[model samples]
Target: DAGVTQSPTHLIKTRGQQVTLRCSPKSGHDTVSWYQQALGQGPQFIFQYYEEEERQRGNFPDRFSGHQFPNYSSELNVNALLLGDSALYLCASSFGTAVQYFGPGTRLTVT
Candidate 1:
């Protein structure tokens, strides 16, 4: 019955570094979605995964990628990170197309 969870509540990295964020889906949930939220801005869809396949993607470059495991857990990977990438990364889980519940989010800061 646990809700979605994300790791490394806060992170700081220099430009060009690579980062990996993790998430665990809520109980009985099989879909995971990722989002990026900048300061004073709403979250922007990054992508979504269902049945371990990337079902849809947002307007991000290839540098942004993700994977959902058999257990429904997921990870977000960003390569050659830029200062502009600094933002709060959120993980949301849902059952099929049902309502999604989000995690606390991981705050990433690129310097």
Candidate 2:
């Protein structure tokens, strides 16, 4: 049984550019949550989607958006990227409020 997975393990972008990160949840999971982790800091919740709807969101700005597909996969989009946006984006999947399983994360560098 494969766990959650993310794509483009590493990415480089420039300020003012836009980027989209993809994630696939583990089998049997229906909820996906996205987080941003800065160097030497704990992960900060970005948002979460369930049933194709945004169930919750964190303190992130509107530039951060997400979508959850019927198949339980999700995507995170960040627009007008800033150097501060450079961090490890993580995807965690869970089953109806259960424990979440996280992916290796996507490292984004905004220069």
Candidate 3:
């Protein structure tokens, strides 16, 4: 019955550094999706994972990647971070095509 959860509610990083964000899907969910929300902008889908494999990806560069575990938890990794990478990284969970439930997200500040 637990809802989706994310770690390190806030994070700070420098340009060129990498960061990894974590997420736990809601109970009974088998899919996880990652999103990035810039200041004053709506969430943009980064990628989605189901069955422990990436099911879909967005228009992001190769620096963005993700992994989903058997337990339905997931991790998002961003390499060669840039100033533009600073944003709220959101994790959403869904059971099939149903509505997605989002976590509060990890605030990433790239300087």
- Candidate 1 per-residue C-alpha lDDT over 1-111 given as tens digits, one digit per residue, 9 for 90 to 100: 678899989999999999999999999999999999999999999999999999999999999999999999999999999999999999999999899999999999999
Q: Give every collision pair in model 1.
A: none
User: Against the hidden true structure, what lDDT does model 2 obtain?
Assistant: 0.97
Between 1 and 2, whose TM-score is larger?
A: 2
Determine which window of 10 residues in candidate 3 has minimal summed lDDT.
Answer: 64-73
lDDT of each: 0.97, 0.97, 0.95
| lDDT winner, 1 or 3 | 1
Q: How do the predictions measure up, each by TM-score?
A: 0.98, 0.99, 0.98
Better candidate by lDDT, 2 or 3: 2
**Model 1 / residue 108 / CA error / Å:** 0.1
Cα lDDT tens digits for candidate 3, 1-111: 779999989999999999999999999999999999999999999999999999999999999998988899999999999999999999999997789999999999999
Highest TM-score against the true fold, candidate? 2
Ranking by TM-score: 2, 1, 3
Q: Clashing residue pairs, candidate 2?
A: none
